[model samples]
Target: MQTFRTEIENPVVEKDIIDLANKIELFHKGKIDEEKFRSLRLARGVYGQRQEGVQMIRIKLPYGKVKSNQLRRVSDVSDEYSRGRLHITTRQDIQIHYVDLNRTPELWAELEKDDVTLREACGNTVRNITASELAGIDINEPFDVSPYADAMFRFFLRNPICQEMGRKFKVSFSSSDDDTGLSYMHDLGFIAKIENGVRGFKVMIGGGLGSQPREADVLYDFIPTDKIIPTMEGVVRVFDRYGERKSRAKARMKFLIKDVGLDAFIELVEAEQNAIELKTVAIDADVYPVSKPVSVEAPQVAIKDQKAFELWKSTNLIPQKQDGYVAIGIKVLLGDFYTDKARLLADLVEKYAAGEIRLSLRQNIVIPFVKEDLVPFFYTELEKLGLVEVGYNKAVDITACPGTDTCNLGIASSTGIADELERVLKAEYPQYLTKDDLVIKISGCMNACGQHNMANIGFQGMSVRTPDKLVAPALQVLLGGENLKNGKGAFADKVVKVPSKRGPEALRRILNDFEANANGKTFYEYYQVTGERYFYDLLNDLQDVTNLTQDDFIDWGTNEEYVKEIGVGECAGVVIDLIATLFFESEEKIENATVSFDNKVYSSAIYHAYSSMVNSAKALLIAENKSTNTHAGIISQFDELFVESGKINLGVSFSELIYQINKNAPTEAFASKYIESANLFLDKVRTYRSPKPLKGAK
Candidate 1:
């Protein structure tokens, strides 16, 4: 494992991998707490899969961009460390499953060799920053948003502020008003816009998709591109300080905004502006690498089936602004593909195109900068690799998560039913192959990893019980959701819950009604006109569980009887209440603060120091059996119990001492003073707890 130290050139990355290796050893030796270890490993992108004793490594790709060499490197790592299979996530990340936990550091080091990383790919950190897959080449875009998305990813990769928040924060960049990046459902969403001849973005805040979906509120009609980074910083700072920490369900930014009005949330965000490191971060789009199409003669090829080729071309070709060039969309069924196809696709794009591919949010692949004349050649090559699926971003192209296949929180077989639905569409509703208006998404549970709640037609995996007390796999059918461009959207209404075995029949019924009565309107319009009650009545017959067959007891992708076994999810990482662990973590936060101070990142250093003080106070509060839920609550309680009560002397209220973070500018003097204050505070808390040994003190 030490060999990676020599191979990795970047010292920071090298230290990260070494730290992960050391932590794993400590965890195995029972030195690190299990919950603490889970948080640490998750922040490093190592996730626990549904299968016991295995891990899922999510490789972060900013804005879904992947160079040919990077793709090849990832494929090699997957082949070496995993089972030669890669799963594309809805966030545009690549996940390889069934990996031994001990080999993760080496696997991560291998990925970083090609400038690919697994850091901040999971856990409470900022997950992958996704963007429009057609960002650079979209004809409708005002300007390429790829550079802005890249800047955001770079600025926050290892930044101290969002490392371990109460829950994860999501960000997205839409290329245009089309909202292809799905801005309406992200925590912070940016849509590229040009107002008054200046490049900027339409900013949205506090939107999210889950069991409870909320549309993002408009923060700004347009803000200059220079303000995006600083604005995001302020938002993250506010969320960290005031967001929920005790209730995992209420930890998302949306809930905070919902609890407090958006106006008040905006006020809090504005309050942090003075403490922000940079008021404006200018992003030079000119420095972003430009993709150039290969200038070679098109290879002559004979089309085996002309009609099939035409249908594929009609559905899969993406129009580019550049003349004589088009991008190809490969509709990856269920988001699962093997490394053999990946490596070959990498080679194909590298030789004939711009040596790059973008992973779509819908878990598909887009090869941009391909010459129009080479479509047939590329089609033939892709056909050999089984990559030429005819329904790219169409009705038949369903998006689903790895439900029951890999995710611990998956309640039903999302992939199995997605497979069956695609087959049904191909056989019965061939016209849907080119129908791009409808979207069908499935999630094994209500977490909406599949974005099921925001699709035109959605299905949520669940279990239903019969009159005889027998449980069977079931799906909740939802209808009428639509993404109405420019940060506006609607969530689907749950119409009915039917047996999983009857899912195909439910789809058939919906499509049959739509085709007969839609009157050439789009799916959204048709759904709006018909209403949820109409769909409920239409699919009500399938909801009957009285005459259940043996097949109803079986889930889609399995042979055994359905036994619902959902494991604890590691989505936001677990909360650790161990007093010793909290104290230990406080020390670690101080160390991080010192490192950030040495690096001259005063804002980050100050936040790290603030976290240390808060953590230390929380430790003492826990010793007193107090509820340390939100940071604000911790500060108030610590002041009441320790400062006012005279248990620990700080000369002032804990709130006044800790609230200096937002009150003062993050200058060197304040950061140095804050670090000293944190150290002093930790010392006082330790001395206070030393004589009175905590009940479960290690």
Candidate 2:
């Protein structure tokens, strides 16, 4: 029941924030304060991200769709609170940033005025439930899952069980293979298909987000729509009872399914589903009222401008499963809006567009029902609003998480890096897009806030050093990640670890490599055929440095690693931040961190509870003989975290340590000291955060 303005990262000036939340709880007497509880909703995020001045606010819009008024309110919140920027996420939710700490309560109040809610936006809560954007309009839809998504959203909002679930639960629904929703990578993905002449959902269990993503296992071949609620209750109950509670790393439903087999997990879900009372199912579609239409004039098309209309035709519209209607794709750069512009957009869509508008997963708004004739006029009005940019599906559109700016869990300025990279790419290498879709995604931390693990070429911002001896935030290129419905998680293969400034050029170089080797196919298909090795060799040719002279890096993995991976697809890249950080000056080097050619070093928060991937990345490989007992308190403190790169194995061979030492010229304690200091540095990071793009990265 924390207020919208109050978060773990916000400076708790008075106990008022805490007292207020407790008061809210009392008022509810356990039930959600359906009306005045707007401020108490948004609980999404890890703590490390918000220590910086920047704030991330997630809005819950069920079924990946929203109304014109709701959309306007989102834009108003952006203009009023944030720096007029929104990041449309892979999840259907909208995340706004650059919010002032004091103004957050006001922002929440404003959102409530428009009937918008930020509840269930973060934390271990059931995040905004999502369904295919075309749910209501798509004729192929088995049964509109919008109601189900709506039902779940209403059923769980502020429900204590889901509000503090062991882990975040992402639910997505799609109809058939024209899957706009990435059903495979969700905690629960429901795809509509016909079985036995009955349209029903193929329930999928345990899929999720990460570098180690798992596709959901089928829980039911086809669960009828009526059974959907009961089925979901079963799954939640299973997670509630058996999901790993102690280890955050093992808390996601995917881990539970992986540990106890999908079959057994389904059995648990079935047991729970069987217990739900259908007669008392908690839902009133009329009360929750999703989206309805208003009459509008037929759209007007300008016949005078063929070229403008042609561009509009190419990027503005998408095929609706319905023959008479089409869905318009309105490109939203960084998903931002002004209050006036929001109002105008809403009016424009309401007057000329079919009353329905949807918020796309790409962080853009969609006008679902624009007529064929009004194409040109809509384009003109849209241009007047300055929202007619046609580069969204292209590289100019890069989704980013609000890094160090506001979230307590952030490690770097994810959005800042993404914005810079996207700008550089659009100006420097626009041709890369003409070659084919080169999705460049960026995240602030290992929490995968930006969904970097799902893009074709993703970048997670981290502080890294260059060969020239300077520390700054940089991006690590991930290759070949996509949602494969057949089977397999998207893989973001490890490629080049470069300074953020060089990301654009590196992106261009990689695309050029893809073009030269692509033969004649999409970049993805080419990478699929050529393999990671081909891309690695190309990167080897472009490598700017060959050696490091300091003890600042904690290098992990074998010497012959994939310097740059090709198209190895989802959940690739061995977590090597620790090993990468330890390669510096023997005596003065920073420990548990890596130094680049520029003398910049990278290390993670030692006490970063949310960072399991980076904490013990090197420890998992080095043998017990080489391992120093890290936690030797009066009480036994077994290192609960182990970060092993699936690509590298740390065998019991101290002899192999010889191979690792750039040269064993110094005692191992020399390396150990740096690691110890780095750990302390990490511990301190949790308390302090630089504003997003605040000072220099170093």
Which pairs of residues collide in candidate 1? none
Q: What is residue 239's positional error in candidate 2, in angstroms?
A: 1.0
Model 2 residue runs over 4 Å out of place are 1-55, 75-87, 98-110, 279-305, 420-438, 466-470, 486-489, 541-698
Q: In model 2, where is the ten-residue run with the lowest total lDDT? A: 629-638
- The whole-model C-alpha lDDT of candidate 1 against the native structure comes to 0.92
Instruction: Write down the lDDT of every candidate, Cα atoms only.
Output: 0.92, 0.56
Instruction: Please report how far candidate 2 places residue 649 from its true position, in Å.
Output: 50
lDDT of 1 by residue, 608-697 (tens): 999999899988899899987788889999988888988889988888899999889889999999999999998889889896654333
What is candidate 1's CA lDDT for residue 586? 81
My TM-score estimates for the predictions, one after another, are 0.98, 0.68
